[model samples]
Target: MLRFLIIAIGAPLFLMAMPAHGFARLTIDADSQYRYAQSRLDSGAVDEAVAEFNRFIHFFPADPRVPQARFQTGVAHFRAGRYQAAAAIFNQQTVGFAGSPLDNQAFFMLSRSHARQGMIEQAIVDLHNLEALSSSTDVIDQVRYELGWLHVDQGRWNAADQAFNRISPDNRDRFQVANLKQSLALSGAIPFKHPTTAGFLSIVPGGGQLYTSRYQDAATAFLINAGLIWAAWESFDNEQYALGSMISFVGFGFYAGNIYGAVSSAHKYNRDQINAYRERLNQHRQISLSLAPSPKGAALCLTISF
Candidate 1:
């Protein structure tokens, strides 16, 4: 009877100890994995970090840090330039973790990833959603500013103006908006060369190039066509009909090419001027927003504004 009682008591104690020991081991493993993943991410081993995060998420689905793991995975994809994948992950987080603290951040990252991929429409949609969902005034202002900048990038000046107008005059971004307005006005006033006029001027061999301010090209075109035409005339006068025909054919080609080249150059010149102006505008815009690495060291923060 004594041996039977001891066996029964020990069996239950052993069963209890087994589960406790297993739980302890699992916790230790989870902690180690989390730390290792974070270290990998800090070291810029994005792929390895992503893999470790995946492993942790798979094994510790109920862990409180799972949300952070998912977010870090997306950030890893973003750092690797896998924008579509990053966007997908963030999009999922936005929906799956709705009302969670990470939701707003995920939504913002989703928009950024979309923007990086040149999916402007999708980015704008996400930004609008962020605006609707966020109660933060700063977040709303950032959304509006981003929307305006997107319109600027697409050269939709009217749309950009509309977006900027949404910002209150008292807002800190007022100066930036004013600068953008000035840039838009300047762009409108740029005197672009007419391609038709350029082509018409090219009737005089290299006159079109001269009109486009391509002085060296105009000189080169004029000399080449003039020399070829003179050669053709001399050959014909000497009764070398075949040689004269060849020279005439070559001369005509160069003459026609000059006309076409002049038209293209004029159009390109206009584009270049516009692009240069826009580049300066972009530089000024960048000065208005400050970007720095976030506390996580995995993403950037655009919080401080000049």
Candidate 2:
């Protein structure tokens, strides 16, 4: 009885331990690997997360999560400030899986990447594409909202207003839209100096600079030009033809430069005013988004404050 009992227990134990020696490796499945990649990303191990995500995509191309993995990889690149790479990946997501639930989100992200790279027109185009393709109100609203800000950045106030008007009344940023309109109305009053007017006024030596509010430059320009003209006239009166011609030539050069400088100063003044206006409008307003990996799919989360 004792021998039979020992054999029964030993046989079961032997059978249980056999697998360990049989080289049956404990393999991580797609879900576990994907979760690991996501955890790495959340922890700010961006490079590692990208590698792992690529691995998941490469090994589990048949898995539905591959799309999410691809997206997460793009998110990783985006978080790392590799905007071009992020854009490329997001573009693939948009093209490779057209009409998928993630399509709008991918387009939005791709546009964001382009915007970050200072490709504003390209970003606008992508957003317009997303707007046309998406049926979801939420997606359309997001696209229009982004389009409004982009137009604002480009100083297209009318276009921005149109974009803002198209957004649904239920948009959370409706009150902020009112503030934007108020600011846009004030934009007309922003100080501006016309380059052409400045150039034309420069015919009077220092008049252009004075018009542009460059008092010191105006005085300097006037004094220098007056001195050169006086010297050239004196040289001519003294019958020193060579000296008069040289002085006159140099004065003419200065005169031309003064005109060019005045036009440039006007442009600079306008730019400064526009930049300041933009700064005030952008102040206390922001919009940002990212893709969050999940078991079901990737969630595009937008955070906005105005």
* Model 2 per-residue lDDT tens digits across residues 1-306: 999999999998999888888667877899889889989998999999999999998888899788788888897898899999999999988875455556667897899899889999999999999888777777777788789888888888788878877888787474367777777778789999999999999998888999999999999999999999999999999999899999999999999999999999999999999889888988736566645556675576764523
Cα lDDT for residue 46, model 1? 99
Per-candidate TM-scores read 0.76, 0.81
TM-score of 2: 0.81
Could you tell me which residue pairs clash in candidate 2? none
Tell me how candidate 1 scores on lDDT: 0.80
Candidate 2: what lDDT?
0.85
Best by lDDT: 2
Minimal lDDT window, size 10, model 2: 284-293
lDDT of 2 at 105: 72
Q: Cα lDDT for residue 179, model 2? A: 76
Q: What TM-score does prediction 1 earn? A: 0.76
Single out the weakest 10-residue window by summed lDDT for candidate 1.
287-296
